[model samples]
Target: MSADDKYPEESGRRRFVKGVVGGATLAGLGVAGTVSVQSLTSASGIGGGPVEAMTIDRTGGPAPYGMPQVPIEIDDEGYIRGVWPEVDTEEVQGVEVEIAREELGGLQYSQEWFQYCGHQSYEGLDPNFDSDNYFKSDSAPGYDWQADVKDEGDRFHIDDFDDYEEWGNDVGNSGVGKPATATWRSEDTDNVIPVVIIRSSRMEEAAQESEWLDASTDEGVFAFVNKCTHFCCVPGYKRTGESARYNAEDRVYCQCHQSVYDPFNIVSTLYIALPRPQD
Candidate 1:
């Protein structure tokens, strides 16, 4: 049985969040990396209750964003392979090769970055499914997002490469500028992952300097799991309207709690809860 099947009340994602903030001690959870609870609580002041909170203290100079390290393995070919089975190995390898050889900038929008895996469509998903029902809010934005997907005869064929160049390369477009997204399915697991590729103008500049490239900058290509770390919500890319945030660039926004995660530096901060209030 899958981890989710064994733990019906809480999926792996929810359990992880709970261990961090729901008054559970972190000593034996076997979480991937080390993160100091004191650092997170001292930085964000997200104390009290069983929920994990993050606030950008605009008035408090710079809010201390602690980097949460995600363990990643690189092959001899410079491909990024995650320890988790949900990761798409072939896709990530191709991307890493392109980036290492500096051929990523020449890639067309119709390339592998925009290919959708044919496991299932969001429309066919049950909103009440365990994966979708974990959010605290009743209104799951994914439902509306699925509805907004233009029908292309086949539900699995969600991506339209015809306008990809115009939407991804054109900076003036109001929608997510310079980014393309697609969905991928893992053969080893039931996880349906969403991937986004961002083409930044800074890539050329960074390439010329011979310095380590920043994933958020123009000189890099980044791909990450679409699941929101906060509540396991599948964040929509470039979504607009009252329910969505205006993401003009390559960013992931969770509609449930309006949690914004930068795919480029997602590991930069770890959010942990302080000691639980005395009973």
Candidate 2:
């Protein structure tokens, strides 16, 4: 058959392949099937009788459906490396991220999903991320954690750190209980996005004993890519025998060159390569 005869349009073929392969990939990784934005039942259908005087199965009042909830955890390295109740992708529409630092009292980062709700014009956005800048580890060396993230689809996106300089914030805010607002200017396009921040400390608590909406064993499946932004190296965390927890006295060990970072302020270039400068 001719190419045009077999495929009437380019999108016709691409759409078919995307649909078939997407499900296969998700299933192989044990990811729950994606949910749609459709509603299950109507509120008006409840609370009425069948016949003139029959209460039949309609003997009900106002009721709500409680969807099953799942628990997940975040590790010391600041990763949510665990399974979770599949969330509605529409939820990608609105996400609240809370990142707390220093005994859950310092740096409260919050970004309501409402900002990115409607369609946006991404013209001139930098998809290449070449113009993006990294906040040197020395600037915020008080804590050290890594969050490595990757995805097959556009499920994840990055923001340039330069855009948020006015707010006095930076990335690497994914540590245990340190919440910092993340700003990324799309390299491929001209768009800036914001997300709520929550770090790994809460995960430790959730792991010890599950409670509240944030506690879940499966949530632990995810982990943050905490490598040094410059050399792409991993930093060590404070062990039990360390000087003290989350204090400058405690340091984040860099294996590449025995470099130690104070976990209470910004990082320092005592021995290893220097970290990128913060805005």
Candidate 3:
């Protein structure tokens, strides 16, 4: 207990001072309330929104120009699904789909598309299935859309209906009608989900063009059914090769679990059997 021992060495005193100063500096910054950089990166963590929230533009309805909408198909029941709309089944009919299996570099590869994969149609709706108020297509000309489509005859195609057309139809036909849920792979990438087209029976009924129109009333029913068991996902329907555009061989395909269903017959088991909500 000497005076030198009680006073401690100069070096020890300096160390104590430094520690105290550092603690005070940190306290002034409110370290307890400060957030970590790692937490900001996480979605549910502290501070501002996560990385996706930072990058996502949720200000208005459609995203800013040049920003991809991140392919997401929301079904009538509000489920995330996928679908392809490349081929209009009403335009193509009575097709045969083929499947080829190949192994490359020790990796197995299966070729699938609309006709061969499988499909579910949203039929029993109305003529001009394309025409609807909620339907939005940036690609189609003038966007001739409709809530319920009007049969314009064989000379007309669904693609011919644009958003503007739909808007006009919406004005003509009031009330909010639900849009058909569809999903499909992006033609932009190979890894993109697979999608196909189901040729509509209406195409076969083309022979009955006279039946489509009746002198009874101005409003007529042109039945267009979508066989997709799931509401929101895209009906697997497309061709793989250059010759497959409008390929009759393509079948229904599921991009989520790589399930392939037979568009023609009732498939109890396929890739992964998910519950199909009854209509």
Candidate 4:
């Protein structure tokens, strides 16, 4: 695909934050209105308000919305990388602030999507944070196959998921998808951004039907920030036997609260984003 088929060039972008958001939620701030009020005089950060983001479908649980999808690409050598949005500046409430946003898959995809849950203040969310932008294997993984295949700090390669069509474990039926536990835009920082990458024939089929899926995913590989929206807990895809009890055997399930998400579905969700901590 040409550069035009991908995100806009870096020379001009109405964007700000270009990295995965961090962990932790604003303990007392759940309502967007309350967060907006504090945004006025908090003198603590930049960019906070209601925003729409693409996410996997949240089927059951206390989560207000589904986890945000992370756009990805496979390089010439087959390494997978998360697509970071562009960085630009805009004024909010009369204050000049940097923001990361871009038009993709028929909507405005931005850093704001990952801003809630204290992600706004993470070092990785800094628009200027430098990284090669590849998704790296986590030191520890929920899947035994992943632990046996990849070591800590290894970049994911599309070739690694060769048997995704029939891959299965003790948790669920075979052939749902293959998953990788990883981190994005989190090198050299205390804040580790958890990410989940999955490859499946289902995704390839979906991309053929949806423009958004076609643009954001490649080789049946797609990803999302691994934290649960309800409690910021890490979730797994077809990783545990307990998921069967909740009818989530073929989906992403959060053990923290039994929240279930359908990876086969991607939808839009609206939530208040927290401003990045200004220091």
Candidate 5:
């Protein structure tokens, strides 16, 4: 590579971000490192700590890890919903604490995976937040076609994405996937959990080779938290034509910081999940 292709020296803040990214990459690689028990419990929350989570691969820019995958299930009625794991209490540090945790896709799936970026305090994160756990349409959607097909708060039906096999927009290539914007576990709550859903044949092919993907996704459909790990900014897949400049035209791109994530390269990411507020 030529010097012209290299990024210039970064400032202290950028250096710090890169350092954390490196550590997270190592953790995902199963290179065990030690963190003090005090550090894990220092934060003021109930369940924050190093959590094993399934995420879309972070291929470029400064995000420390991929966006957390939201395990989903399609109902008999053909509506899709995010899977909230079973709720129960566990003794941690000798005190009983309520948590949403269960084994799925060969992993300890838990609410801690979504406990970060201040989402730790969302009422919906409560193990028993009263809602059907369906992915509801956002009032303001990213894709124009979504607004045309469904109204705000309408549950998405699989038939809504019948064109996914040949879906196209002005942003990226055609037949990549069909996308949607929605909220999960947020009905009647002050805080909304932003979510992104995509239906693609590519996912169908990948799931065949991955145990985690097979259990978390269904019929080529999957969802993830829309927040970028870099700075909590929302990112989108094939939403911006400008992503071509960063060579991210076909991936989830965070315009705010030029981060890119590959949807098809899902991997296990060990990330520090923040704890929820005390009940």
Candidate 6:
């Protein structure tokens, strides 16, 4: 099915949101609100939410899927060794690395599935459930649920789908219409950071207004933390006019409470307003 068919119209979005709210209440959980930076980092999980043990597809046999080594060289001290426009030297204490288009094709896109009906199972949620294996470590032998995310991108391309046409078709179990994400280790802090990259043709206006340093020069690559400023639920990207929460244009949307953010604008004002309930 096309994205239009998969993602409902505005009215349909209202129903979906309503269903989600009702389901959460039934499950004895409340919607999360704004959160602090400290709390966000400490959560160590996806969007400061609980981590669930997910099953892996050991059947396919593990293919090579980990942080690919980039041209950005890291020194023995773990600092990036070159100067690039994409990196903030002050932040990383080394040369900033710029992610090239070719590199993006090799990187794995992050996926997320929402099943608000309380029906819990790996099936019907994710197609490439094993794509998230990178989040898990050998020492920790389970799915790192916290690792699945779609929020910010640094010198990274953010879009509704990781590979627009491919993901739109739901190939490789790519969570089409779901938030697509990628991650890299910052040479500066030596921390693995998740980012959302947008290359949508329709997001020019929003990108011009974003906080991304290179938004002006780059093709709308703005990176930020994947956590929602409010309550920290992993917000997913919705294509322009896909749902009621994103009635006008493309945006980052929080399923928890229907909070909508502009993918093009700075994160501070991205939260334009809350979606109004249908009367």
lDDT (Cα) of model 6: 0.29
List model 1 lDDT by residue over 3-83, tens digit each. Answer: 432122322344554444443223322221222343233332111112221111111101122111112233453433222
Q: Which predicted model would earn the best lDDT? A: 5
Badly placed stretches (over 4 Å) of model 2 are: 1-116, 119-176, 207-279
| Residue 117, candidate 1: C-alpha displacement in angstroms | 21
Q: What root-mean-square deviation over C-alphas does model 1 reach?
A: 16.6
Per-prediction TM-score to the true structure, in the order listed: 0.35, 0.20, 0.19, 0.87, 0.87, 0.31
Number of the predicted model whose TM-score against the real structure is largest:
5
Ranking by TM-score: 5, 4, 1, 6, 2, 3
Q: How many residue pairs clash in each candidate at the backbone level? A: 7, 65, 63, 9, 1, 21
Positional deviation of residue 168's Cα in model 5 after best superposition, in angstroms:
0.4
Alpha-carbon deviation at 163 in model 2, angstroms: 25
Per-residue lDDT of model 3, residues 101-125, tens digit only: 2332132222211111122112211
Question: Model 5: clashing residue pairs?
Answer: 48-275
Better of 1 and 6 by lDDT: 1
- TM-score of candidate 1 versus the correct structure, residues matched by position: 0.35
Candidate with the larger TM-score of 2 and 6? 6
User: Model 2 over residues 168-278: C-alpha lDDT tens digits?
Assistant: 223223233332222233234334332222233344454455333232222322122133221234444342232222231233433432224432221111111111111
Name the lDDT value of residue 174 in candidate 3: 19
Candidate 1 backbone overlaps, count: 7
